[model samples]
Target: MGSPICPDCYDYLGHVVWQYHAPELWRRAIQDVSRQLAARLGVPVSKVSKVVSRQYGRTAEMQARGAVHFHALFRLDGPLDEGIGAACGVGVDVMVEAIEAAFSRAQVQAPPTFECDQSRVLRWGEQIDIRIVREGSRTDDPDAPITGEQVAAYLAKYSTKDTSLAVPDGAHVHRIKQTCAEVHEAAILRAESRRAGEEVPVPVDSEGRDHYVLIGKWAKELGYRGHYSSKSRCYSVTYRTLRRRRARFQQVTKSRCYSVTYRTLRRRRARFQQVMQEETERAQRAGKPVDLAAVEEALLSQEDESETSVVIGVWEFVGVGWTNQGEVEIATAAAARAREYAQLRAGKQ
Candidate 1:
């Protein structure tokens, strides 16, 4: 379920309220909505262990209307009490009803404006979108269920987007600019009032300090103040954990700093072939078949032990690829020789 602030709240906050205070108002409204939802679901605030809930918030802008809105994902685990209703858990229909009821009941008191008092009630817009996410389908697909991957990717895409309003000529841009100008004018008025030792029209905090003077600071965002992305603590894995896991993987797979010369490689290959030949000869002399699996396992164990041995040498860098056509022919001849050797070893086995 997604809900956007009403037009009246939008205009009042963007034009009349200070930008610094806008975030606080938004936080209050979101909390109110959450509280209402919890109340509807019969979840106690003090005892949160009964129901596990996760929420993620995404702030987005409408290109045509140039207004900012929120997109949120709510995952509810259970009602837990089987005695209340069905055997497994709460029904999808009941959850949807709770969402709608919460949205309707959620309201915030708007700050006083020049034309009106502070008693005005602000609520969500009429256009509330509610969609049930089921397993194995998408929100747009009515026949299929919603997959976890799809929902995660959808929310992540919106979370990383720029929250700035779109560029378009017309009343939307004009109104945004006009509201910013109003904020600036209010700042100037507050400053002048302070200098003259007269009362300011803007409200003050408990400390008796003017709070609306910082409204012009967030004019770039059209006074829509909120984080681009927010989530509950238990919603997902932390970035630090992911980075640490990656670091550990890299450490495990990182190659040791050692140099290998062409001569060394040839020597190792020759030693391997000689060992295999000796083993085959021994098996024939004993009139017994060679155990290929045992031979492979022994070779692997030897390799693992040899990995810790330090090879001390400084080799000059040779140019990549075959230096000449003769070198390429030589490489091909060596590969053919290796293949012949392998075939001979296979026949012996």
Candidate 2:
């Protein structure tokens, strides 16, 4: 759960940048480890069985000082059954060596640094911990239950998280906002370190909006949005495909079309509808007659029945559109005209 970072010494931009690349770094590290194992065993990368199947995994914020580090969990297919043990050998010393080697060699370059300092570096934290699977064991203990599920879950969770000033979500909005403000106030803090910079952290809870307002510095991220994960093509199925399959199955079961579209729909005359509903309720309570005004109000108070009522505005880049009161009024008027025309036709009949 810890990376080699001197909280007092590490650069803030470096910390934020690392958070941005952590997912890629982890993937590369795992791939390198697999390659190392394959080379040692004299087998193909595909042949070596992945003991842990990462159904889900995440990364979380690990802070040293104002700087950030990482703690990750990776889920596997099963417990460390055979391939990992055979690859790393029997003792924990061998496991540690293999892990260290993979992490040490694994490097992610920053985009073409022209500066004299050239921050494009390849270094992992010195604080490396490797453990084997054992139930009811401590995380620090080398024999803890590092199950496939445990690793995947751990990595997946933190994959989308950063330090206090990293990103925004419902659970930690207050803390994130406060930290962002602090970082903003400190001139010592680098631009990237101030707030998630390029990396966008997703919320642990999926039901809520990916809000960035509570943590304003994150507005630069275009709404706390970024790629939360990076996996090799060989890893497994994708989330989108998985969801599509589930939806297809549901559609088939329900005997409906599987196609779906995401578009903006406007409902106009909402206020008028509300007023009509209220009046109807009052009439019911008073045992009064429900007449033409009530019926017309209810019918005309909707966009589907009248096009001119609500004005819908769309922002192409942002992909959002909504209706205002003016549009609602126009649509209501149109609905009333249609009703009048219908009544005229009925009179002629």
Give lDDT tens digits, candidate 2, residues 60-158: 354423233445433333323331212222344434455567888998864311112234564677776656544542365444466655665567656
Residues 148-210, candidate 1: write the lDDT tens digits: 667678777776655442445555556675776675666567667777988655566566644
Clash count, predicted structure 2 = 37
Model 2, position 283, has a per-residue lDDT of 63
Per-model TM-score on C-alpha atoms: 0.55, 0.39
Worst 10 residues of 1 by lDDT: 79-88
User: What lDDT would candidate 1 get against the real structure?
Assistant: 0.56
